[model samples]
Target: MQPDPSSLLQQALRELDYGQQPANLYDPIRYIMSLGGKRLRPLLTLLGGQLFTDELGPLVKPALATEVFHNFTLLHDDLMDQAPLRRGQPTVHEKWNANVAILSGDVMLVRAYELLFENVSLPLLPQVLRRFSQTAAEVCEGQQWDMNFETETTVTIPQYLDMIRLKTAVLLGFALELGATLAGASATDAEHLRQFGTDIGLAFQLRDDLLDVYGDAATFGKRVGGDIISDKKTFLLLTALAQATAAQQATLAQYLGQPILDAEAKVQAVRAIYDELHIRPQTEALINEYFQAALQHLERVAAPAARKQPLHHLALQLMDREN
Candidate 1:
């Protein structure tokens, strides 16, 4: 029987080891790792492998590797964004100084590689590492593109979609792909799982975009309408731009990027434009499209109905979230 993800991950985390050579470097690693997250990537990795192997005991190392690398990316991203909080607490850069956070984050990446090196089998190590390396670089590239879009006023919907694909979706894809590969699943089945994860990741990000503006403030964890205040060129904003009348476009240009404006007023005004353009419904349509595409791919995976049920259930839970 498949154990619940939370119990399995908790057990895995307790056993997961890190070096203690430099207290300063390792302290931050411990601090960040202790800050709880969903552990989705690692869970997916294990589940992906389980589609082939009933035991799933041997896949623990690579599953944790995905989680470690995921946290490493989040640590650096928090610094780069100057984010104040992560999981409702001070971010690494905020808690420590930027220099400490930078050094600590670098060590965390090295440690992630170390974990990979020590755990994976000799025969499969090279292929696993190669895929992981590519995913890491693409995540960085996606983050760079997101930063670029912050200042560039004319990002197309297609371009923004591609950015999210690289930034967010690929790792989810790699997580499932790695698990399947380790379990000796055929290349074809692995590819199907990868594509399914990618599509679901896309839908997940778009939901996040929607929530940034419309979510209940307490449930959302950040200020509501954050994307509007920052003018972050999300799917809603990009589509609004496409559908807006010339005068409405002028209104958007007037309110957005004005430093002197009140934050609440600016959010309300931009959201007003969004409502006029029917951006919310349009974005929902697109999100549902991706969600359906994900389900389609999940259907194509060559696993038995019972074996695939857990993944199918997890995908539904993710898609139905309001926060």
Candidate 2:
């Protein structure tokens, strides 16, 4: 049976020992890992392995690599975004300097690869490393695309979707596929798991976009309209631009361009236009479409029906049961 995800996360955390040679360099690694999130990606890795094999021991190190790599990206991402807070605490760059954060993040990347190699066989190691390398590069490409969208107001729905796919979905895909590969799952089944993770990631990101505009402030952990205030080209804004009329488009441009307005006013104005264009419903429909597509991939995983149920349940929960 699969270990409880929460316990698995705790156990993985306990096993991490980044060493003490350079306290400054390694402390940040420990600090960031300590400030944990849902640990979903690592859990996916463990789950994927368990679905194919009874023993989960070999999967732990490789699975933890995904989370380590994930945190490494976040360290750099926080620096790039100049994000003041993460998990309601000061970010790596905030607590330490940018140079320290960069160096620490770099080491984390190296460590992530080291961890993945722990239990993987010499022959199969190349396959896992190659795939991990590709996914890591794609994440950087996605970050670039996201930055591009900031100035280029003409970004289309497809373009935004692709950006999210690279930035968020691909890692999630790798998380699931890596476990299956480690467990010696067939190539076809592994591919299905990867596709399943990717599709679920797409829908999960859209849900995040929706929540940014509609989620309660207390629950969201930040201001609900921070994206609108900053003119971040989220799905809601992009969709509104796509479906709005010439007149509606002009009004939107006016609101988006007005940077000096109070935050509430800007959010309210943009959200008013969103409601007018029925952006919420349009986004919800698209999320459901992607969620359903994810299920199709999950169904193709070739695992026993019972083994697949846990992942299936998670996919549904992620998309808000729209599927």
Candidate 3:
């Protein structure tokens, strides 16, 4: 019998820890992975693999490779963003030396591939490896673009969308496609699954941007308005830029570009302008647009409805989540 999904996740977590050398490195990996956020990407991949076959034995380890890889990115990202905490704990770089953090991250990538190719059929393993490499490179390109946007004074909506497509969405799409391929889905079906993941991932990122500025602080898991405080070029900020009036433009310029401002006051100020321009509703509408597109692709996949229902519900939950 196929292992239960929850059981598979647990088993994968266990397998990830096998064969660690340095206790220091191994302990931190355990610590970060144990911090516990929604393990959505790996779960999606496992679900994707199971859509074609009941056998999860071959899929669980590779599916978890995605999660490990993702956390690796988070470790490095926290360093780059100068983020003090992750999931409410000190970031790896903060708790350990930067060189150690970098070295550990490299090990995580190596382990991701080890898990992926360990039991994979040799004939098909190269193909999986090549595809994974391409996806990994694309994710890096996306991150670079995201960083580039910080120095950029002006960015269009389309450019922002494309940037996010690479940075945030491609990995999600690749996760599904990876699972589908492992399960022997037809290439076309795998592509459809990938498209579904990409669409939903885009929507998910947009929703996060929305929640960062507007969500309730209590339920948001982190402080609301972080993006606004950092002056990050979120979709909402772009939309506000597109719609602001002369006075609104001056206000935005004065506050968004200024330093040494109060967090709560800045949040309240920006929100007042967002309200004036109705940017919140407009952003919500755009988020709905991507969700609809994702649903359309999901409905076209050649999988059984029963098998896809859980993933569909998961997509909905992610799109609607506050945190």
Candidate 4:
């Protein structure tokens, strides 16, 4: 019997050797990888493959490639955002330095490609590379758009949705598609799985936006309202802005315009706006929309229901939709 996805990935990560030379360059890579997360992307890859075939051994390296690339993005993202922490620990740039973070993140990208090229069958290599490259470029585009939104005052909900889809959802789609492709699933089936992943990814991110304001700081693994304090445009904030009365708009603007205010006061003020506007339910409704769409796509995949159960359960669990 194949090992569970979590255990399988843990063993693979433990055995990965980044080569010890100039500890500074390689150390950050190891450090970030060791900072545990849900390991969701790679696990999706494994589950994607399981939908088509039982021999999951060959999918391990490619699945790891998704995880490696993901962390590489986070490493650089932290640097760009000037974030102090990741997974509740000092970020790479914080622990080391910006230069180290940049270089190490670059190397991580190279290593992700290496992992992909190492095990992918030659016949499948071109297709895999093309998909991976497109996804990588889109992720960058999304990040750039996110940064642009910080300065641009005209951002819209549709634009925001597209941004998150590219920035966060596409990688998830590609991960699942990669696994299905590697496992010899038909292109049609693979695309269905990809759509399922993309939809789930959208809901996952929207849930994150909701959690930032309402979640327990300890469970959320970061300070609640960090987004509010920064005036980072999230779905909640945007929705509230759209729905607020002129008086409410003035109130929101009053709090948000302050160059400096007590962090708690800012959070409370913004959260009060969100609460009055029913932004929580609005966000939750949108999340459910995407989640239900994901399930529809998952149902369309040609695989047996039993084979698809793990992925379905994972999707439910990730979105807190599980009964």
**Best candidate, lDDT:** 4
- Pairs with backbone N, CA or C atoms under 3 Å apart (clashes), candidate 3: none
Model 4, 193-257: lDDT tens per residue? 89999999999999988888988776776678988988889999888888999988998888775
Residue 33 Cα positional deviation in candidate 1, in Å, after optimal superposition: 0.9
Estimate the overall C-alpha local distance difference test score of candidate 4.
Answer: 0.91
Instruction: Write one digit per residue (lDDT tens) for candidate 2, span 1-323.
Output: 54575586688778789877789899999999999787889888878887798777778888889999999999999999999899989999999989999999999999999998876889899999999999999999999999888889589889999999999999999999999999899999899899889988999999888988988776676678878888889999988888889988887778786755678877888898999999999999998898888889888888899988778877766766232
Give TM per candidate: 0.96, 0.96, 0.95, 0.96
1 or 4, which is superior by lDDT? 4
Q: Over the stretch 1-323, how does candidate 3's per-residue lDDT look in tens digits?
A: 65677677886686566346787677677777888777778788888888898987788888887888888888777777777899889988888867778877878788788878895778779988888888888888888889999999998999999989988898899889988888998888888889889988888888888888888888877778989998999998998989999999898888887893588888888889999989888888988888898888778888889988878888878876643
**Candidate 3 segments whose C-alpha is farther than 4 A from its true place:** none
Candidate 1 per-residue lDDT, tens place, 1-323, comes to 66565577789787766667677667777788889888899889888887888767777777888888888889889999998889988888888778878888888788778777787889889988998899999999999999999999789999999999999999999999988988888889999889988998999999999888877786777789888888789999888888889999898888777783688888888888888888888888988998899888878888888888888888888877553
What TM-score does candidate 3 get on C-alpha atoms?
Answer: 0.95
Candidate 3 clash total?
0
Taken over the whole model, the C-alpha lDDT of each candidate is 0.85, 0.88, 0.84, 0.91
Error of 1 at 32 (Å): 0.9
Candidate with better TM-score, 2 vs 4: 4
Q: How many backbone clashes does candidate 2 have?
A: 0
| TM-score of candidate 2 relative to the true fold | 0.96
